[model samples]
Target chain A: MPTDTADPRYDYALRPPRLPQPVDESLASAPIDLDVRLEMYRKLHLLRQWSKRAHDLFLQNLVKGTTHLSLGQEAVAAAFSSAMRPDDYTFATYRGHAHSLSRGMDPGEALAELLGRKNGVLGGKGGSMHLTDVTRGMMGSYAIIGAHLCIANGAAWSAQMRGTGQVAVCFFGDGTTNIGAFHEALNMAKIWNLPVVFVCENNLYMEYTPIDLVTAVPRPAADRAPAYGLEPIVVDGNDPDAVYLVAREAIERARRGEGPSLIEAQTYRHGGHSRADPGKYRPQSEVEAWKARDPIPMYHDRLLKLGTPEATLTGIERQVAEVVDAATEFAKNGPEPGLEDLLVNVWADGGAEWRN
Target chain B: MAELSYREAVAYGIAQEMRRDPRLVMLGEDIAAAGGVFKTTVGLLEEFGPDRVRDTPISEQAIIGAAMGAAMTGIPVIAELMFSDFIAVTWDMIANEIAKTRYMTNGQVTLPLVIRTANGGGVRFGAQHSQSVENWCMMIPGLKVVAPATPTDVVGLMAASVRDPDPVIFFEHKALMATSEEIPDGEIVDTLGTARIRREGTDLTIAALAAMVPRALEAAEMLAADGISAEVIDVRSLVPLDTRTILQSVAKTGRFYTVEENPRVLGWGAELVSIVSHEAFWDLDGPCVRITTPHIPLPAASSLEDLAIPSVQKIYETVKRTIGGAP
Candidate 1:
């Protein structure tokens, strides 16, 4: 599907993100051009800005129900988004705002979805927790903890059966390892040798509790990978370069029919789990420590160290701000869905009636 | 036309569809190589090869979720949940994900898939294995529920479910697995939301599903001997319920009885009765009664299980007692 033909900015074909080449298998030796680095910076800026804005919308009582914001974990989404093929599939959890946007979901439509507007990605049907745009291969934002992990395997299976080299990247929290579906999905994916990459964004906390307190394993996802005959891959989720390197390897491995990989990306959610959580449970010292290692500034500094001009980085930030502002305006001004919408989309015929 | 056992009809139906739709895949535990625990899918693995007719682990969630995911991506799948009772383990995938994805995404994703399971009991499989849970799927909005009674309906309905642009729960009655009937030649694609009037009469209407349909038909036969004309309708589909056929049947007979193998509480019959009472209120002469298993787990003992589930005698007696008639 061709996206935003009218607007070249959103046209992926017009300006594709430069990722690690297939020939350059080693991320350590691979030279990422300044353009790709800037693109990564742009995505990071966009994700952080969009998440904070969406959080504000929730605070203003515009976004109904709860919104799970990926406030601090922009790098994982950005890195994977950059590394993934346009045809590759993404299955994300409730904390998937960044994942959806990284897949080129229109910021306006995403915000409108959060605001329950008719022009929303799902036409106000799937609220904040379920932002989906299948055209972009953003399959769904699954609210259920471990369900999509199993579902992602199916997509991978489909890709394998059809001989389509599309890799399915499934994103989940650290706590998902304990869920039955998680184990089931991993085992099946390995046995089938499916083209899938299970990326666990270990945000330290799962909902309210710290993940380690409840989880038996030290590394929730990576530690358990050995049981499923997969390598225990750990990446710095807060570092875009680090995640991008790991994501490229796993994605390539899956696409090459090397089966599935479980990567536990260590990261932190800047805000509470959702709009309802104030996150008072965390010690102030721990909170400050994670906040200091915030991804956006870290990436910006990395680009500067790599000889990218300060003006170029600030220019991307400016562009990101404009996009976010426009999206917010569009969402705020978007119309609510008509009452008739309630009856449609329940079936393929676009009607909810079960019987005559 | 050739006669096929209900179990054979299952394999035939799947084979017929798998041949037609290249994208169609089947997944379940012990389905392939082992020919399914019930042997419903005996030849699928040999015919389609391992790529399509692969066996899954005992992960019900993985099987159903994989089906939903495959369906979402244009590969229509037919997932088997060995027994209907195992639905409890994968309820999150079926009820929340598969049933709601199309709606939640505003029709962005249409899961053209089928989750076929061996349902109900008569062979003493005990409580867990012997359950008629079609009512569970019927209540879910996005699912199209069907329980085919005969071998012919199994072949026909399986075709419909495979071709339909929605998720279908195809419930094959465990007891009816051995029952054989003549299936029409060529492809047997049936409609999803239509009811089949197995027998027609004027005195009363007895609507039943899957295993209960045979009992209802038998009871109708006994009722005829007693000089009471009874119509037996095979309610194959529960979600896109054939209320039109049922209401018309009730209007003609002026009396209604639902023979169900599900427990007494919130059975599929309850919904049909509610719809019938409201729409065909003027046509009904007396209160509609439901003949179902008592709201308890089915016992392993044959005598107790036979007593628990509505029998041919029970169906015969219920109608005979309600609208009293004797030769």
Candidate 2:
């Protein structure tokens, strides 16, 4: 059961165009400043624990509506977001809580939105699936899979039109690449040379089903990128540095108006599609193997191997925990929106635009 | 003070807006190099350059979805669909994504964009290519629906649609594109929920939309010959409907009649009838009437289509019958 190394007996989803592994050493040193790398590790660490706490809240029936957490997929969210600038907009999918956090939406506001609190981002109108902080360039979260791909391309087009040189990053699942919107959006992005980065969270499974069953293409989905005239970059998603390196390159390409790139981050999710179901379909051995490569513990061990002092590591851990604890309190204590806010911001001058 | 065809007016309206606002751009299949199948966007690409007027692949969902994104990012876009029937294919983007984004985000986002598609079935484009289901768009919240009857209304309402803070679906009729009229050159009437009184009368109110507006005018002339004075009101914008004008006209005429190309059951006219009953039931001298096509899928044959689609003759008879039956 000890998954310290890749067991030849177990399948690591090995196929042609094989993606790199989490333990790939060459991919680990992503050229990030030591302090910033450690800080990103801190954020990934908080996301790892925050997802667990959120799942616990869901179990207690405290969280409203359905919830999808990126428990084992923190590295992709953290690294890609770290590579992004503040003005760069990002469009995320339903399992986008970590994506929002990485974009600087306060954990408290995100949690409050999930809990339907008035003080939450978007005044609780957009729950976990539709989280948005437009000012910080988190355009919005889409519950519909593959729906935001074109929207991301549109945002990229906006920047290109304004000559802002800003990039638009879209975070979707492996399943999304099959949808018509994905193909349409990618084709348009490439045809127009749009400044967008499409990062597919290739988490092996699309909900309860293995992606192979639902899609004609193989895992990581980026193999089809060439057909759309876009270069595909497959990386070890569980390794933050690997994800960071490729994401930064693609984002820079976008910023320079070199068109779009597809990064198929071969990561895994440790939880169900949402909070209600346990991911019983994944093989026990495969789950344990991926669990062994869990981004938080894996990165922490890497940091330790780099000879960070034990006290410094503990201090970083304590800081992340305090922030998470404070976020939990803030979300729990946030006020509920009043009746008057039912239709605010819907129109210019607030004089009933659409008539509901 | 120059006269223009509906097609010319459409092109001019968009050109004026693009010149006025650098943020305004347009995209669709063949809209760029080809100017568009209807030629409404003829000179736009040449005028604004390729960056502003883009021609996209045959992907309706992507076109609308990209426009929503551009609109959110402060770039207002004019997305064109070659035919209105394709809305059925792209309704998910229009209904689920674009329509719900604003309200769902608690107004954190505003989609200042327009979806310009040629609607109605008079051109024998068959079932797949022709439709007037503005009613389908009518049901969705957070969307404004506008169908302009003439060159003037087309240019004016389109300008309004481009400037509106929310998403607007601009439904242009294929049959009316070649129709010419003296539209005030470069006039941008940026208003919604306002109806235009085409011709005044006293006996009954004939509320028509898009292609039906011209037919209704013809019907009014035919009715006037028979001493059945009919006041014609072009129900220009469907959503945020011009209820005040329609109701006031109906109150004066004592009868109401609607004509549209869509199917009769649960059609756009049904919504108008409901609004009239609720708001002006007491003013009505008789039951409201609607002259709409049948529920059957539109046949390809021009002869067969003529049997189903509403015409001036149908509107005249429907108005005469409604008023004749009334006290």
Which candidate has the top score in DockQ? 1
Candidate 2, which segments miss by more than 4 Å at Cα? A1-22, A26-30, A351-356
What's the lDDT for all of these models?
Answer: 0.89, 0.84
Q: Write the per-residue lDDT of candidate 1 for residues B103-140, one digit (tens) a residue.
A: 99999998999999999989899999999899899888
Write model 2 residue lDDT over A93-142, tens digit each, in one string: 98888988888888888888888898788788778889888988999889
Chain A agreement with the truth for model 2, given as TM-score: 0.91
Flag regions of model 1 displaced more than 4 Å: A1-30, B324-327
Q: What's the CA error at residue A155 for candidate 1, in Å?
A: 0.5
RMSD of each: 8.6, 4.2
Candidate 2: deviation at residue B287, Å? 1.4
- For model 2, the DockQ equals 0.57
For candidate 1, write residues A90-163 as lDDT tens digits. 99998889999999999999999999999999999999889899999999999999999999999999999899
User: Model 1's CAPRI class?
Assistant: high
Q: Candidate 1: deviation at residue B172, Å?
A: 0.5
Could you tell me how far off, in angstroms, the CA of residue B202 lies in candidate 2 after the best superposition? Answer: 2.1
